[model samples]
Target: MVVPVPPPPLLASHVAVRAAASAISHGRRVLLNGDHPPQVAALGRGDWVKLICGASFEDAADVRNLSLVYTLAGVDCIDCAADASVVGAVNEGIEVAASIVPTVQRPWLMISVNDDCRDLHFRKAEFDPDDCPLDCSKPCEKVCPADAISLKHSMVDGERTLSDPLRGKYEGGVITERCYGCGRCLPVCPYDRIRAVSYVRDPTMTAELLKRDDVDAIEIHTTGKGTDMFNTLWDNLSGSINNVKLVAVSLPDIGESTVDLMNTIYTIMEPHFKGYNLWQLDGRPMSGDIGRGATRETVSFAAHVASMSERPPGFYQLAGGTNSYTVDYLKKAGLFQSSNWNSGTATSEMASSHQALIGGIAYGGYARKIVGRVLRKIPEQFGRVHIEDHPDHLLEALQEAMSLVGPVKGYIPSHSKPFMKQVDRQ
Candidate 1:
């Protein structure tokens, strides 16, 4: 009698991929059955999850992969750079996800722009690798969460070897497209060679993007120092403001004046705010990948905002340093999807109507970090990696993404072992 043969690794992975895709589809179908658009209802119910592709991160391939993974995992929105190419990348990812899972709901495509050049989200780290000392320990590479820095020592001449002192040069520096201005590399560099270059998004270009049919939301990053810059930027985009389904303002906690600033910004937006609005309470911007502690600031910011009686109108959400611990923190603070909010506040109406006090969470660095680990496993030999093309890698990445997105969506994967392993590893 002939012995039975086991399936090859590729075929096994393909079966696993199908299983993962089915699980994701089931979760979305369960969460999205309400009368309201799934995103809006999620906002009302406080289970909304958004994937923030960094405001300055413009690597199209990476963005596309990230968008695909998060979209499959059932995020309500995808926030990405305002650049045309970046927006295209996000849509491409979403489209690919839809083709793979025919029933997947298309997430809102949101573009992120900044009013001030000083805003940390609108910058990139720069350094001249050739200037790096041959003997220097490259802490920048190790500390960078984005893997944006690359360095290699090369011989200076035909006679000199890489081992010869002062005979080689550092050939690679910050990969600008991959750098999202985290600034972790700045302080760690012994030579102080790294510099952050900041920029403001062009309003004309942004206005044109808003006119696109696929774009669904816009997030304006403000420093909260004053409203002059905010007013100016808003005026520039006023003509196209009505095109989006949602408008978000991302700002940091500025002590006692935080609520006052939010009200002022709301006042500025009231007239043209024809759609739903959200307040992104950014705690420690771009630090989510650090560890569990990074999520605290955002959670604290949410609690502070939730307690305010005079806060502005609009759904409230947490961002900046959000991670796996954010929901637990919110639950501990009595704010996760809790209809019982602090009484007699501007948000009381939402509470009485059974909407959640805190709308949801936006995972940026932490979200990317989890899935990126799986992405990095994809061989560089396969240039311009479309994640869906590699079923094995895609299955692994989907598992990693679901680990972060599942809890918020109340999704329990058919195979819990891989999901639990990812959560514990993180």
Candidate 2:
């Protein structure tokens, strides 16, 4: 069987071990071994009589990377050579119990990922020359995030070289560099983008595996180059960066003081983000549990669908809660570049719901307050104060819905919110 190991850098090389091959055509050889029967001449091909019994075919050209198309437990069954030339804890012996056919491609089967590839996890960030000292080479310096590595100076052609500063020299203890071992430079670099090189399943490798002809199945192994390997693929399958519309605003609908204050904020701040932001989707009619809104569920569903379709999907999370944490999640979800969001709901939804998310009414109130604040601060009042009503399209639709609700409309509280509530004693 062919074992395809991760191709390590030049420093460390990986090798494939061949497994053994057993099982010969027992019934056919013994019973009809003597008969050099006809080779299906009637089927129409050339004149070649063939042995009806099976053959324990062994050809060097037929073997290469071995992979288990299917699996029962942690054990695997791959298509390699007659030798145990593969990786895994399976017995070092080969055994072909029945119906052995010689072919190039292995059958396509599902293989469980157990101790499949541990070498990759630890080797995620590897360097050449394990014994290489942290001299001025700065091999990992440019990649450090915390700027933790302090450096000393070394001169070239009479000028002090800053690019490759020697880290804490042993001084007369190992006498090397010229400058006083100043640790200042290291602590100053932000090193925000520092990290080990990342890897993904090689597309060419996949194409090659899919080309297998002997076995009916195909299996691939990864050294876990990323956090969510599966998600990394699917979430990024579609174009990574999705361009959509978004905005920020505040609305009033939750009622119970929250509504009143929110509306007040809209009346005040709506002008700030108005006419600019796109409507957020995860909004409107605050309900039980944020997930109760169809938008929330829909967003999650989109994520799943992306996975199935081998593509990435967009998101509509609110922005006020936006900080390092949310950004990190978005980045991990591969949605950072695809998400569309604004600050408030009232203004955004009021403007448009064209693929947007709406969250808290408090957010809308805040947006309204922003509008009021911005307009109030502007130097001009009349002709200069051009309020854009484009954002109100969704609100307008809701308004028409209310008018059509008829008798049931009286029971339904206005979405605009002078929010009255059912008096539950609880």
lDDT: which candidate is best?
1
TM-score of each: 0.90, 0.17
What is the alpha-carbon RMSD of candidate 1 to the true structure?
A: 6.4
Give the alpha carbon lDDT tens digit for every residue of 1-426 in model 2: 999543222111000000011111111112112221111110011111111000011112111101110110001123221111121111111111111112111211211111122322111232232233435354344433212233345356676545544432211111111111122222433432222222333433333333333222212222223324433322332231112112222121222333233233234333332222211122221121122232333233223333332111111223121211222333345543241333223332222222222111111112212223333343453433321111122122222222211111122322232111121112
Model 2 residue 288 CA deviation in Å: 47
> How accurate locally is residue 269 in candidate 1, as Cα lDDT from 0 to 100?
88
After superposing candidate 1, which stretches have Cα over 4 Å from the reference? 1-15, 28-35, 340-352, 413-426
Please report how far candidate 1 places residue 311 from its true position, in Å: 1.0
